[model samples]
Target: MTDSNQISVDPNTRGNANLIYILYLVAIVVGITSIVGLVMAYLAKGQGDALLENHYNNQINIFWKGLLYSVVSVILIPILGLGILTGLAALVWYIVRCVKGMQALSAGQPVENPGSWLF
Candidate 1:
């Protein structure tokens, strides 16, 4: 009996994706793991099934977008005095994105919008 909702994700792909998500989460404290995860995502891109590929794309986008937000927030620190708030928002945003990615990956589903700027 086959379950139509069951998804068979490749073990290697799932493992790598899971690790990348964890690294992103740990990066909040360690700060270096995010870079490692970014590299992993780049290397793993286009090397998996469609669902895994979507996750890789989402992870890559998260890195670049997070960097942009961080930079913009820093730049606004002295100019507008809102940098701190923006920075905090960026951190929350990053965490949410990672959590969402992990959830989707666990369900064997592609990210809803891999390139979305907001969760």
Candidate 2:
């Protein structure tokens, strides 16, 4: 019997998934680079590629949240070094998790990232 819960996902697509995750990691390192990749990935969604769309959407959400939060923290520096410290810590953790998530994707598996909290 065919299980309705089964979804069609190619194991070989791990490489593609890895590519997307790498964008998130890079966003941590280069900042702007990740943002550009996120935008490009988002635009690629309308090309009729559902899997890629989902992948890019995940990366985009992560990129924007990290980027925005980091900027906000910097602005709050006047309140003391707490904001900056927390922001940097969170940013570092985000990058590490992004790398781990990429490894998961590269193995044709799923990962739980902060962005995944949305849905």
Candidate 3:
């Protein structure tokens, strides 16, 4: 019988977390999977180790910032044609954040700054 008191850690935690970040990237193309990815990040929030926690935080940050920027872009859509450029920038920023987070997770490292505004 397995020891009930024994604590076992899953070796796939990092990879699983990385998959969420990958989903975020895919969502950029598919445009709907981001909801699933963000939900997974929230669901896994307290279940991961420190590094994974940082990744979750990073993912959450990206989602909120992307949403905020998108809202602002929509508001400015009729102003001087800047909204198109702003929306495109926000999309690129979201992709970069996801890619960087994935790279860090793949390297088994925590994000240096999960709440940073700049990439």
Best-fitting candidate, scored by lDDT: 1
The number of clashing residue pairs in each candidate reads 0, 0, 0
**7-73, model 1: which lDDT tens digit per residue?**
4344346978888989999999999999999998888887888888999999999999999999999
Which model, 1 or 3, shows the larger TM-score? 1
For all predicted structures, in order, the TM-scores are 0.88, 0.65, 0.86
Better of 1 and 2 by TM-score: 1
List of clashing residue pairs for candidate 1: none
Candidate 3 lDDT, tens digit per residue, 80-117? 98899999998888888888888898888888889998
lDDT of 2 by residue, 1-119 (tens): 88866543332344445565666666555666676666665655555354445555566666766667678788778887778786877677667656756665566455554365332
The superposed Cα distance between candidate 3 and the true structure at residue 79, in angstroms, equals 0.5
State the weakest 10-residue window (summed lDDT) of model 3.
Answer: 4-13
- Candidate 2 regions off by >4 Å? 1-16, 27-29, 46-54, 113-119
lDDT of 1: 0.90
Q: Candidates 1 and 3: which is better by lDDT?
A: 1
Inter-residue clash pairs, candidate 3: none
- In candidate 3, clashing pairs total 0
Error of 3 at 16 (Å): 1.9
Two-way lDDT contest, 1 vs 2, winner: 1
